[model samples]
Target: MAKTIFITGASKGFGRIWAEAFLKRGDRVVATARNTETLKDLVKQYGSTVLALALDVNDRAQCFAAIKKAKEHFGTIDVVINNAGYGLFGSIEETSEKEARDQIETNVFGLLWVTQAALPVMRAQGHGHIVQISSVLGMVTLPVLGLYNASKWAVEGLSETLAAEVKDFGIKVSLVEPNGFSTDWAGPSSLHTQPLDAYNKVKSDFQAGLTDDIFGIPEATTDAILKLVDSANPPLRLFLGKMALPWVTQVYSDRLATWGEWKEVAEKAHGK
Candidate 1:
């Protein structure tokens, strides 16, 4: 059965890929971007199947209004892909307070606003899926993009809690954690803080070690997304990419080791 998919940041990147995939499979798409004009090609290609809406996710009113329009246009949103976010690239100390706040507002709060706006409609309909486009950074830490990591980590926590809260309401939630995909997330879409000389060595080493092969193919990621969406028992968190599993596995193993290594001390601190 063809479904109605509501995707944010559908102008480009993974969001656009997902929109194309769903449309190709005969689904209706309510695509949104800050500049709705960017979505014209989708409307041209898919015709009435696509409804491009103007949305600046950071603005609460715009978020709610866009969702309202989506509901009005499509009757109900079957699945929502919150894929609108930019990375903040810089060391923790180098990133200004303003930069950090702006990153959180767009990446975290924006997602929340859209979800909040969609929930009522979903609840009324009694079935929906909310997909959050988080990153591998959400589970594991990265050096230069700590702020970006923090934002995704927030998404992870929120989605996890939300999944439990909404299960009884026939609403499903999933966090798609992609290992670095071949996107402009670290390039044009990123906000770079003024370089701090103190962290030159760390920055240089991290940048030098980067490789294109680390990125997963976008098409493969989209295929995985389609599979997840079709699943009656979708995972609370699904990691994409070859490195995603290994890296996330390491994060857990390290955490478990740390906990076991410090078990006595941990229990003492808890007054157990």
Candidate 2:
């Protein structure tokens, strides 16, 4: 059966790839982007199967309007991929107030608005899947990506809670945590703060850690996403690169070790 998918940020990168994949497989797509003009090619290719809408996810009213239009167009929304977010590359001290606030508003609050708008429609239908496009940074951190990491962490927590809360409504929530991909996330889609001389070495060292192989092919993710959307029992978290599991495993192991090492101190602080 063909499913109806409502996805944000469908103009480029993984969003465009996944939307094309779904349309190729005969699914209905309600694609939203800040610039709907960028989505013209998809509409031309897929015709009526694609409903391209202009949406700035940061706008709550637009989010609701888009959802309403999608529900009315497709009758039911089987899946939603919240893929609209950008990377804010900057050290904590280097980030400006406006930059940080904009990051949170678009990445965190934007996702929340779209998710909130879809809930009632999904609840009424009794089955829906919400896939949040988080990043490996959501679980760990990078030196120059403090704000970006914080946004994904917020998404991680929000989506986890959403999964637990919406299970009774037959809504499945999954976080697709991808490592570095050959997306323009670091290019046209991103913003960089003015560098602080103190953090120059930190930024350089972080950049040194990245290699060509660490970046996955964006198109290759289409199959994994398709399978995820089609699954009867989807995972709460799905890592989309070879490096995600190993990297996250080490981080958790170190965290557990630290907690265990501090167990006595932690218990003493409780002081029953």
Candidate 3:
């Protein structure tokens, strides 16, 4: 059966790639972007199967309105891909108030608003899947991306709790945590803060680590996403690249070791 999918940030990157994949497979898509002009190709190519809408996810009203319109147009939205966020590049100390707040606004609050809007429709239909495009940074961290890391961490926490809350309504939540991908996520779509001399070495090392070998091709993920949405039982979290597991495993192991080492101190803090 063909499903109706609502995807944000469909102008390019993973959102556009997945939208095209779904349309190719006969799924109806309500695709949105801040600039509808960028989505014209999808509309032209897919015609009636694709509905392109202009949306700025940071606007709460636009988020609600877009979802409502999609529900009305598609009759039922089987899946929602909240992929409309960008990365913020900067160290914690170097980040400005505006930069931090804007990051939160789009990556955190925007997703929350969209999720809130979809809950009502999904509850009424009694079945829907919501996929959040988080990052490996959600589970681990990298230097010079503290704000982006914080945003994904917020997304991870939010989506996990949502999965538990909406299970009774037949609404599913999944966080697609991708490792480095050859998407404009790190290019034109991202925002960077002014660098401080104190952190030049950190920034340089971070840039040095961005070798072509680390990034997976963006289009290669379409099959994985399709399978995820098609599954009768989907995972609460899905990592989308080779490096995600090893990176997360190492981080978690270190975390566990430290916690174990301080188990007595932790218990003492919990005083009877």
Candidate 4:
């Protein structure tokens, strides 16, 4: 059965590749971006199968409108991929209040708004999938990428709870945690070096190391996404890339170690 997929941030990066991958597999894709004009070529190539919508995920109204439009055009969305997000790199102390709020608004709250709007439609249809394009940062925190990590962690928590809440309704939520992929996600659009004297000693080298331009191709992530979409029973979390596996394993091990070391203190502090 050919399913209809609604993907945000479809103008570029993993979102764009995922859109193409679904289209290639004969699935209808309702691709959205802040600037729909950028998807002109895809729209032309896929014709009616690719319904391109102009959507700013940060805007609640836009998120609602996009969902309604997608439902109208595609009849019912079998999958909703919330892939619209950007990275914010800086020490939490160095990041401005406004910048922090903006990061949460786009990367965290925007995803919430989209999911809120899509859930009703999916529930009505009886079965659907929600795929969150997260990152390995969601599992582990690094030095300068605190803001980005926080956003992804927020998504991870939200998606985990959402999965349980909607499973009875036949809605499946999956988090796609890709390692660094070669995309504009690490380019100029990526927030970096907020210029704090406190961070000067650590900022330059950290920023250089954090650049994701040299990572695996976007196609690899897309392939993982497709497999997840087609699986008989998909996992709640799909960690993509060989490089990502080690980091994820380390994160789990580190967390367990920390918990074990602090177990006595934690129990006492909690009055247990």
**Model 4 agreement with the true structure over 47-134: per-residue lDDT tens digits:** 9889999999999999999999999988998999999999887888888988899999999999999999999999999999999988
Instruction: Flag regions of model 3 displaced more than 4 Å.
Output: none
- lDDT order, best first, reads 2, 3, 1, 4
Per-prediction TM-score to the true structure, in the order listed: 0.98, 0.99, 0.99, 0.94
After superposition, candidate 2 runs with Cα above 4 Å error:
none
Q: Report every candidate's CA lDDT.
A: 0.92, 0.96, 0.94, 0.88
Least accurate 10 contiguous residues by lDDT in model 4: 205-214
For residues 115-197, write the lDDT of model 1, one tens digit per residue. 99989989999999999999889999889999999999999999999999999999999999898888887789888999999
Over all chains combined, what TM-score does candidate 4 have? 0.94
The true-structure Cα RMSD of candidate 1 reads: 0.9
Q: List the residue pairs that clash in candidate 3.
A: none
C-alpha lDDT (0 to 100) for residue 146 of candidate 4: 84
The per-residue C-alpha lDDT of model 4 at residue 266 equals 90
TM-score for candidate 3: 0.99
